[model samples]
Target: MKNIVAVNDKKQLASFIDFPHDLYKNDSNYVPELFIAQQDMLTPGKHPFHEHSTLQLFLAYEGDQIVGRIAAIQNNNHNKINKTTEGHFGFFDCINDQETAQLLVDAAAKWLKERNMTSMIGPVNFSTNDICALLIEGFDGPPVAMMPYNAPYYQQLLENTGLAKKVDLRAYKFIAGDYNDRSLKLTEAIRERLKRNNIIIRKINMNDFWNEVVKVREVYNGAWDHNTGFVPATDKEFHYLAKDLKMIVDPDFIYVAEQNGKMVGISLSIPDINQALIKIKRGRLLPFGIFKLLWYKRKIKGLRIMALGVLDGYRKMGIEACLYGLTIKTFQEKKYDYAEASWTLEHNTMVNSAIEQINGKLYRKYRIFEKSI
Candidate 1:
C-alpha cells in the first residue's frame, strides 16, 4: 500500500531532500542540488521566505521505499501583491507511477485547502523569483544552473491529477560561434547616443557590492512589477540572495545603466556552475566536494543571463541593447562555449524579439501548472 506522510522531523526532511538523488541516480542529466541550500530553503527559520510565508513538506512511501515528495506553500507576500489566495506546490519529485503522483499531489492540495487557498499553482519552489517550472522540452541535455529538471512522465502525472498549463517559460541558447555580433558592433553607437542623454552603461563594482546590490534591487523591483506573477523581494530577501550570489558572480557579466549617478537599469549573467556541481556526489560540499567545486569552477564554459531589465522611464533608450551587447562582448572575450538567457515569459514579445535578434535559439521550454483546489 502507498501512503503519504508529513515531513516533521530532521530524518524525514533529509529523506525529502535526498529522494531525487536516488530517483535520478542513473540519469546522466540529473544534477543534485546543494544539500545545505536545500536545507535552508525548506527550514522555516532559515530562509527569508518563511518570514512572510509558510510551507509544509510531504513524502510518499510504499512500505520502506520512498516514492514521491512535494511541498505545499502559502506565500502571503505573493497573495498580498497579486490579490489572489493561490497556494503553490514545488520541490516535486516522484516515480513514474500515476498512483504515487496522485497521492503526492493530493497531500499538497489538502494542505493548501485547509489554509483556505482556493487554487493551486506551481512547480515554483517558493515564488517566481526562485527556480520554478517543469521541464516540458529540451530534456536531451543537462539543465543549466538554477533550472529544474524531471522525468518525462511528470507532465502527464500532474495533468492526470487535474493540473493544467498555467504558463510556459522559454530558455534561449546562444552558442559561441552560432550567434552574430551585430549587438556588439552596435554597442559603441548605442552608448554614444545614450551619453547624449546622460545615461552611462558600466560594469558592476565588486568593491562596492553592497551599494551596487541596493541599486540592482531598485531596478529589479520596479522593472518586473508589471510581470505576470512577479512579487518584489523584501530587503532581507534581496540581501540574502545577493550574499549568496556574490560568491560566484563574475564582475564582467554584471552591468548597470546609470543616469546622473542614479541607477536606472541592470543586467546580470552568472557562470553556469552546474558544470562544477554535477561532479559533487549527493550535493555535499565537504571534504572532497568543496575541492571539486573550487577546482572545476574555472573550467566552466557557459553562463546564464539570469536577469536583464530597465525601469519604466528608461525603456527604448538603448539601455537594453547596451546591456546585452556588453554581456555578449564579455562572453566572447572569456571565450565561453555557450550562454542561456532563460525563463522568459512566453508572452514577453519585446524581450523575446531582442534575444532572437542576436540569434539566440529557442532551445528549451518549461511550464507552470495550476488547478482549482
Candidate 2:
C-alpha cells in the first residue's frame, strides 16, 4: 500500500534529507548538498527563514520503502511582500512512478490549502533567496555550489502532477578562453568616463565586511526590487546570508561600483565548491569529509557569478561591463576553467544581452512551476 506520512521525528527528517542520495546514486552529475546546512534550513528555530515562514516535510512510502519526499512551504514574508496568498513546494524528489509523485504533490498541496494558500508555486526551497527551480536542461555536468539539480524526468513528473511553467531561469556559461575581451578593453575607458562622474569600481573590503554588507544590501534590494517574485530580504535574513557567504567569498571575485564612496553596483561570485562537494559522501563535513573540503578548496577551478546588480539610476553607465570585465579578468589571471552567471529571469533581456555580448552561452535552464490550489 502507498502512504504519505508527515516527517515528525528526527529519523524521518534524516530520511527526507538522505532520500536524494539513494535516488541519484548512479547519476554522475549529482552533487550532494551539505547535510548540516540542509538540516538547519529545514529545522524550525534553526534557520532564520523559519522565524518568519513555515514548512512541513512529507515522505511517501510504498509499504516500508521510502518512495518520495517534499516540503510544503508557507512563506509569510513572500506573500506579504508580493501581496499574494501563494504557497510553495520544495525539496521535491520522487521515483519515476507517476503514482508516487502524484501522492507526494497532493500531500504538499493539501497542506498548503489547509493554510489558506489560494495557489502554489515552486520547487523553491523556501524563497527566491535560496536554491529554487528544477534543472530542465544542461544535464551534461554537475551543478555548482548552492544550485539545484535533478533528473530529466522531474519536469514531466511535476507537469503531470498539475504544475505549469511560471518562468524559466537561465544559466550562462563562460569558458576561460572562449570569451571576447571587448569588455576588458572597454573597462579602462569606461572607468575613465565614470571617473569624470566620480564613480569607481573596486574590490570588496574584507576588513570592514559588515559595513560593506550593509551597503551591498542597499544596492541589492534597490536593484532587484523590480524582478519577478522578488522580496526585499529582512535585515536578519540578509545578515544571515552574508555571514554564510563570508566564509567562502573571494575578494577578487567581488567588486563594487561606487560614486564618492557610496556603492551603486555590486558583483559577487564564489568558487564552485561543488567540485569538492561531489566527493563528500552524504554531504557530511565530519569523519574525513571536512578534510576533503578543506584540502580540495584550493583546487577548485571554476566559479559561479552568483549576483551582479546595479541600482536603477546607475544603469547604462558601463558599470555592468566593468563588473563583468573585472570578474572575467580575475578568472583569466587565475586560470580558472569557467564561470557561470546564473538564474537570470528569462525575460531579462538587458542582462541577457550583456552576458551574450561577452560570449556567455546559455548552457543550463531551470524552471519554476505554479498551480492553483
Candidate 3:
C-alpha cells in the first residue's frame, strides 16, 4: 500500500535527502547537492530560515520502499512581507508515477491548509532566495552552481497534480567569444560619469569582508525589494549564506557601487563549483571525495553571475553595465569557457534587456507553480 509519512528522525531525514540521488542515478546531467549542506538547510536549528518559519518533510512509501519526498514550507516572512497566506512545496522528488506525485502534493497541501494557508506556490525550497522552480527547458546539460535541476517529467507530474505556472525564471548563457564586450569599453566612461555624482564602482574589499558584507546586505535587501515574492534576508540569514559563499568567492568577480561612503549597488558572481561537485559521488565529501573536490576545483571553466542588483535611485546610471563589463573582463582574463546570468523574472524587461545587450542568450527556463489550497 502507498503511504505518506512525515520525516521525524535523522534516518528519515537522510532518506529524504538521498532519494533524488537514487532517482537520478541513471541521468548523466544530475549533480547531487552536498549531503552536509542539505542536512543543515533542512534542520531547524542549523539554518536561519527555520528560525522565523517552519517546514515539515514528508516521505512517500509503498510498503518498505521509499517512492518520493517533499517539504511543506510555511515561510512566515514571505506571507508577512507580501501580505499573502501562501505556503511552499520544495525538495520534491518522485518516480514517474502520477499516483506518487499526487500523494506527495496532497500531503504538502494538506499540511499548509492546516496552517491556514489559503494558497500554495513552489518548488520554492523556502523562498526565491534559495534554489527553487522546476526546470522546464534546457535539459541537455547540468545546472550551474546553486541552481536547481530535475527530470523533464517533473513538469507533467506537477501540472497534473493541479499546479499551474505562476511565473517563469530565465537563465542566460554567455559563451566566451559569443558575448558582446561593448560594456568593457564603455565601463570606464560610465565610471567617470558616475564619479561626477560621487558614485564609484570597485571590487569587493576582502580585507574588510564582514564590514563589506554588511554594506552589501543593505544594498541586497533594498535592491530586490520590488521583485515578486522577495522577502528581505534577515541579518542572520545573510551572514549564514555569505559565510558559505566566502569559501569560493573571488574578489575580482564581486563589485559594489558606492556614493561617497554608502553602498548603493552590488554585483556578485561565483565560479561554477557545480563542475567540481558533479564528481563528488552521492555528494559525500570524505573518503576520496575531498581529494576529487580539491583536484577538480581548479579545473572549473564557468561562472554563475548569480546576483546583480542596483538600488532604485541608482538605476540607469550605468552601474549595471559597468558591473557586467568588469565581470566579463575577468572571465575573459581567466579564459573561462562560459558564464550564466540566471533566475531573472520573465517579466523583468529592464534587467532582461541589459543582459541581452551583452549577448546573454536565454538558454534555460524554470517555472514556479501555484495551486489554491
lDDT of each: 0.94, 0.93, 0.94
Residue-pair clash count for candidate 1: 0
lDDT of 2: 0.93
Q: Give TM per candidate.
A: 0.99, 0.99, 0.99
Local error of candidate 2 at residue 255 (angstroms): 0.3
Once model 2 is optimally superposed onto the true structure by TM-score, how far is the C-alpha of residue 225 displaced, in angstroms? 0.9
Candidate 3, run of 10 with poorest lDDT: 313-322
Can you write out model 1's per-residue Cα lDDT over 59-83, one digit (the tens) per residue?
9999999999999999999999999
Worst 10-residue lDDT window, candidate 1 = 227-236
Q: Where in model 1 is the C-alpha error above 4 Å?
A: none
Using TM-score as the measure, name the better of candidate 1 and candidate 2. 1
Task: Estimate the lDDT of model 1.
Answer: 0.94
RMSD of each: 0.7, 0.9, 0.7
- Candidate 2's clash total is 0
Error of 3 at 136 (Å): 0.2
Model 3, C-alpha of 201: deviation from truth (Å): 0.8
When summed lDDT is taken over every stretch of 10 residues in candidate 2, the lowest stretch is: 228-237
Off by over 4 Å in 2: none
